[model samples]
Target: MTDQAVFPRLASLAGRLVTARGWKRLGLAALAGALATLSLPPLHALPLLWVAFPALVWLLRGSDRPKTDFTIGLAFAIGHHVPGLYWISAALFTDIGRFWFMLPASLLGLPAVLGLFLGVGTVAYGWARRRWGLTGWVEAAGLALAWVAVEYARGHMFTGFPWNLIGYGWVPVLPVLQTVSVIGIYGLSLLTVLAAALPATLVATKPSWRPALAGLLGLALLAGWGGWRMAGQGLGDVPDVRLRIVQPNIPQALKWKEEAKINNLRRLIDMSGAEGWDRVTHVIWPETAVPYFLSSDSDNPDQAPLTRLLTQIAPPGGALITGANRLATNEAGDYIYFNSLFALTQGGTVVASFDKAHLVPFGEYLPLRGLLPKGVKAVAAAADFSAGPGPRAVSLPGAPAASPLICYEVIFPGAVMPREGERPHWLLNLTNDAWYGQTAGPHQHFAITAVRAVEEGVPLVRAANTGISGVIDAYGRVRGALPLGDSGNLDISLPQRAETVPLYADYGDAVPVVIWLALLLGIAAFRPRPT
Candidate 1:
């Protein structure tokens, strides 16, 4: 064939691929989802979503039945999550002797379950497209709304696991991420899906670049506004308070062992008392730094041995914040456990405490516990940990008032703020990333923590076991950090809060709600002329 003929042929083949049916269409969607996964943390190639989302839109457009569309979405999610969450299996290897049986389930089962949300969203998108007789940009808009809705639902459904929302793609690019402060992460996500899928309109039967151009313009504005904010926003340092975050690099396998408890506690004390101990006002420790059950003696108000130790490490007038397991009894007489953070004074007094409200489904407690045999244990806890009252601002002496986020609680976007009263000046996130090894999990967790800081317009102080601990300014800039698998203390002054509260922090998810309504109204107003 001549050069001109060959070029046209390739274009024709590309068109056919977009309109393919059955397994071929499903394969394309799967491929697109896999590509989209690359845009997530550890390999933050966010531009890949431009190709991936367009492919998804094409698959959604070509599917004639809701069942087929559901499968297409499921395939996409499987492709997206299998690789996206592969690091989840890292926790299993920590106890290979017992958890070896769960390796396959750990690797594939989670994605399979989480993909159901995507499948439902696709089914809705297919129904809406067919019901409205929608096409082109209108169809793209509808799909974007549905996709964002599902992502939001995924973040909230069944205790919520919004690990790698589409908005997180912009995490590595700090300027683009500043938009989250205005609209929150879900709002950014709505725009992300729309911008990514808008390219599909260019390939439609009646190809028009107008929608694609609009998407590009929106993206340019996002970048420009973020750059302006970064330039103009005057983020200052809060006076008087200072921080000393200790990353003990404790191994997960031995953390709960009886023999290692004393040594582990000693390690945290040693790290906290390093060279700068006398100067710091707050000494922070990772989640569950004390391996023993802290609440076992909760009934009494007297000082526990752990409290005595913290007093020794903290300066004369300083406070210590650390994580531990607390126990309590329910009305039924069964003992319930909690992952908690305690702020202790140098005189061995418990000044304040915040129990973790959001628990990792399998890691902290098994879901559908009644269905599982009693012998089946959770990955991290032998007994299920009960949920506490949600996020609250815990007051520490000499230090600024702050909200406490134990372990995975920091992953939730708008949900991280205190339930009532004035917003805290900073966020204290205590986590143990040791379970997932030194893999993508910790990196992804750290990125999510940074986004929370920007969204709330508050500085974030993260202390992690075996990892990625750092002091992030309100603008998502890392002032100081101890890298993953490193045992050390990061001494830094606290970053000041923005003088004005960010729009998202004031009105959480209100922007996304407005976008959802707009999409619905567009679908209702859209009228196709009779043939």
Candidate 2:
């Protein structure tokens, strides 16, 4: 299994790439990063990771110092994240009149901030590799550990934005995708990076082939176990809880217009009450679907009619769950707003409500509004939204207990669980992707949201404005979905939550952290490679 025996030419070419300097080193690194992005959602070119990652290994390899490592990783990550997340700026275009200037910041600024995590992670990896003189498969393992650690950091740092975890590349590879049920996304990411980087060993040395072989063996075991898990296909349905998700496809520009408010509300009602409403035990709407003030005590004069207007689609004993802008006066006597979910009975009573806790940094509320430019306020923060108590679940008359995740709130791992009393039967994610329009942002968002079901071992029903509304069962299967920009109501029986909780559900990210530490310890055992 010497380099000459199998990958002599690959080894030779990589040796050359590994010695690249100056702009060429960074250019190749950027290229490798961009190539890896093809594995992301909307285009699942997964095997490209094999090519991209090893090249990245060499790119990091060519750089010798910790400072050099930081720049390389930052370049690589910015290349990866910018293109992968370019669609994020599409939101600004939705309100070009106001958000016209924020476009560049959304496109480049956000990714730069996120990419810093990778830069820092690489610094750690570089220090470890140099400190231990790590090589071959152990070197690959070292890189994978750093990658996953930073990914975990990215998801949690600063209210967290866990978009496009590398594990998501397996979206098209469902059998392998099942691995997330045990390891969670971060764990899946660890294995994915390990496996993908193994090919890099081809050019390194003789023993590297063993690790490469081991990686293949690992994938086989994972895929086979996943296949067995999938074979038990008779995932039962939650009895009596027929659900309907409505996607009104309201245009973002007119969604908040005074003239179009009634029409938008009427459209959602009509669609929900369309032909199949009779069999639906519960109805769902996307984030802020009820763009009007809903509570009777709210300042808006039309609050009473708004509540009764929502009941038109509610079943006799069932409830209609919709996202609304909740109004309240904080203890300081200042008017505060909350992006919240409200459940209403057929009698028009507001039964339960959950405020979104993990608000988007500049989207739901500005971080420091007073210090910014005179009129520089967040798009949704006409009045900054006050943070909620925490994750919560609600028990309505007709549906099983459900935890509602508003918009990007569903992206956080383990945090989706209800803190109330018991684990809920399902996850309800209400998102308004209308801001992103018909773009990869929503598609990626939907894929990311669907995977949460597997992590939590529960059914996830997502209602989205402007599309991607559907049902994801416990196994992460998209049982039903409405495409982006489609205006319709999807009716389906609610899939039952898995009888057993997933390892990820029980351990959250602890499962992945153990894997990372075990590998680090293994690499530590190998004496410094005679540096």
lDDT of 1: 0.84
Give the per-residue lDDT digits (tens) of candidate 2, residues 211-296. 77888799889998988888877688987888889999998888899999989999999999999898888899999998775553
Candidate 1: which stretches are off by over 4 Å?
A: 1-13, 295-303, 331-334
* Model 1 Cα lDDT, one tens digit per residue, 1-531: 111112354346446655688888777877889999999888899889888887787777667898988999999999999888999999988888988988888788889888899999999989988877776678788878888888889888888888899888888788889999988889888888888887776665566678878998998899998998889666777787788999999898889888988898888888888787888888899998877666534335543665776677766676888898887789999888999988777767777888889888888888999999778988988888889989888778887789999888988888988858967889999999999887888999998988999999899999999999998988888888988999888989999987778888988888668877887787677734448
Give the range where candidate 1 is weakest over 10 consecutive residues by summed lDDT.
Answer: 1-10
RMSD of each: 3.0, 2.2
Model 1: colliding residue pairs: none
Error of 1 at 428 (Å): 0.7
